[model samples]
Target: MTRFAPYLFSLMLLFVAACGGGSDQQAEEQTADTQAQATEQADDVRTIEMVGIDRMKFVVEGEEEGIKTGEKMGDYVLLESITAEPGEELRIRLTTESTLPASAMAHNFVLLTMNADATAFANAASKARDNEYIPADMEDQIIAHTDLASGGETVEVTFTAPEETGEYEYICSFPGHYSGGMKGILNVEG
Candidate 1:
């Protein structure tokens, strides 16, 4: 009975080790599955490359240079207005090109909700340097936003377009930049 007891103990140890190994294997499988899903979701999103030029405009990458000189919107010009199908996943990559220091010049892509007052939000944001020029009090007004991108730096934000069909405002909340005409529109269509 003593010899059998030793054998039984060894068998139990092996069983415990086997169960631990199975758990590890399962965790690995779950991690792989999650990664695959993330990749697939990224592939499904439409990505837009926007450059914040020193001229205080958001230029769409690969677009015709003439677009920059296109007709001006009230108090600003729309170098480009993004058009998306309602509820579609979208990614906005914002790159800033400037020779000025970040303190003197920076940019961010702030997409505001339909009801948000873009001008007022920009004014509030200018005072929020501690929050990356994003006004915490007006957070509810934003749909999505990227971190401030300094010269030669880039930032991005991914979000689903509003389900409603309408024009949403997007702006750079940097001090005095929005007034310099650093704003555009996001047109969500059905």
Candidate 2:
């Protein structure tokens, strides 16, 4: 009976070890699956790029700006509009080309909520120099925004399109830029 007892103790140890090891294996598999899913989702993001010229215009690649055909792109106007399906992932790139310094002439992209007051927000942002021309009080109204990009520099931001289907306003809250016509409409489809 003593010899059998020793054998039984060894069997118990082996069983305990096996069960503990299975939990670790399952945890590792779950971690790997989560990483793979994140990678796949990142790969599905869509990218859009635009150039912010010295005239305070957003020059969309492969698109014409201004009120007339082949007119030189200028500020105080919407360069182009964006359309997307509800809840889509987007990456917006803003590249600035200006001879002036950052404080003098920098650009950014600010997407606002459906209910946000574009004029009021921009007015508030003008005084928010410390916050990159984005009013802190209106953070909840912002969907996404890129950092200020100076001349010869580029910046980008990634965000999910709003689940609600409607038109949203996007602008550059750089001082009087919004009033100068540096705003556009984002069309989110139902």
Candidate 3:
């Protein structure tokens, strides 16, 4: 029995080593799978561009002259109004065209979340000067916002749409711009 003990100990060591190798292989395969999944998720991200002109208008599709006064231009393209599905990904690109400087005639896109009062949000945002007209304390009410853009400059923002189906309001938040009808609605469909 003493002589056979050595063989048994060697067998146990071999078994342990084989099990360890299998575990390592499994771990490597899992890591590879996770990396592949991450790559695919990154590919799923999409981008949308919008151009704001000196006439205080946005172009949705076709040539600049094709955009009518009140009409839906294209799918997922918003000129005066925007619509989306709940939980959709949104990328807003805002470009301004004004002869004034950045400080005088800048533009930005500020999207408020559902149930947020647009008038109240715009009013509060006007008071926040250091933060570029965005209220710091009321961040929860904002869904997405772009940086301020000057004449001939552009700004962008990317965010996931809200999960609720409702109409959310968006405004320029540049002092009296909201009162001047520089506001739009983002309608989320059920």
Candidate 4:
């Protein structure tokens, strides 16, 4: 119980942060902050849409998954390779198209910051099922992300693109997805 204190506390903070306080003054302040933040994040946003398949793959527009390349899964083509300008806003819309039930197959987008360890983060996230597959301690490592999308459901996340020019990786933090090659890159430039 004691060990769970920090994790629980963090979760509480995240919940409070996500939901505005239950007071007139706090509600008004929260609304103002949210609107301003939304304006900044939605301004000139670049939208990217994708679909999550049960095979742990992201299929882009008009594309189907599991086309045999006769190559290994590592050689499997990238799910999404994006390009964007530094400091710009990017909105990722994810729709899950799995035939499997939601409890068996759901997907979420997790974009890691430059210094975060992808494998380590994914490993931790797999244990955080109750938290939408997001690890509690990894809040600082994530630049932006969307909630888990159950089958046939859609989720979206908007964020300011990193101000640094480089490649950043994004992945599905579902238990086995990232290890199964459900990942991609975001290339940012000034």
Candidate 5:
């Protein structure tokens, strides 16, 4: 009976060890899955890449660069309209593809909120040369913007879409670029 007792204790220990090891492995797997999900969510932000061409046009990457406007608003041309879900994350990357010098030709992305006067904002921005053509006083009207991108340079900005569904205007704030037709619309849908 004593010998049988030792064998029974040994079997109990092995069972406990096996069960404990399995729980630890399960915990590690769960942690790995959580980290993978976090990484995937971070990568989910949509990226929209466009180029500022010589004709004052913002052409979506891989799209035709010719000056084609879907609609014209005063001096600004609606080159494109991109859609997004409300509160979705967005990353806008703007690159300058031109042969002209920076002083002669540069570009910037200025996204204005709905209800904001885009024409007035652009006019104010045009005079803000000391501040990279971004009007400091009217910054409240802007939802997002990027730094000036000169020829052969690139600039990027990331912002979350507004919760309210509406059309937001975006334009190049370079002195005469907006008037030359460098603008688009960001439509946020419910």
Candidate 6:
């Protein structure tokens, strides 16, 4: 019995060590899984359907020209008018159709966070000629944006909606576009 005691002690120690390692591994795996789940959950908030026509109009209100407070082209799709629950996800898709060359006619969708001035954002973007009209200095204010698309081109962007429910604005920073009323709003709600 005495001779076997040492072996028993060794087996117990091994068992405990194995159990501890298993528990640690399980904890790590659980943490990784939780992070992945959180990322997926954040990906399911808002869905913004955007369409840009050669007429410089979005296809939100079922109009063809464009949505703005002006001439009769298309119904102004108010981006701020779109309200979503807090912690929701937002998916934005942009499309542009034009008969002219891409250089002459191109468009993009840029969504800005709350408290950001649309006019300033647009002005800054217009100056960024090399970065496809996206300003480097004001990158922090941008929530999500789509790549510039020429005629017959389309692009999309998906992001988690801001938790604070408020009015978020989006616009086409294509030079004189926003000033021409190429802007919309995204309203988040709790």
* Regions more than 4 Å wrong, model 1: 1-42, 64-78
Q: How high is the CA lDDT of each candidate model? A: 0.83, 0.82, 0.73, 0.81, 0.82, 0.74
Model 2 TM-score (2 dp) = 0.71
The weakest ten consecutive residues by lDDT in model 2 span 63-72
Residue-pair clashes per candidate: 0, 3, 0, 0, 0, 12
lDDT of 5: 0.82
Model 1 RMSD in angstroms = 10.1
Worst 10 residues of 6 by lDDT: 62-71
Q: Which is the better candidate, 1 or 4, if ranked by TM-score?
A: 1
Badly placed stretches (over 4 Å) of model 4 are 1-43, 62-78
Error of model 2, residue 110, in angstroms:
0.5
lDDT of 5 by residue, 78-112 (tens): 35877888998887888888788899888888889
- Residue lDDT tens for model 6, 4-110: 99999999999988777557778999999898568657764344556676666555543332122233444434332355667766666777868889777788988
Higher-ranked by lDDT: 1 or 2: 1
Q: Give the candidate number with the greatest lDDT.
A: 1
**Comparing 2 and 3 on TM-score, the stronger one:** 2
On the 0 to 100 scale, the lDDT of residue 2 in model 1 is 90
Candidate 2, residues 24-90, lDDT tens digits: the string is: 7789999998995686576977666677876666766454321112244553333567888899888
Residues 98-131, model 1: lDDT tens digits? 8999999899999999999999999999899999
Runs of candidate 6 exceeding 4 Å displacement: 1-46, 61-80
TM-score list, all predictions: 0.71, 0.71, 0.65, 0.69, 0.70, 0.66
Candidate 4, which ten residues in sequence have the lowest lDDT sum?
66-75
| List of clashing residue pairs for candidate 3 | none
Choose 1 or 3, whichever is better by TM-score.
Answer: 1
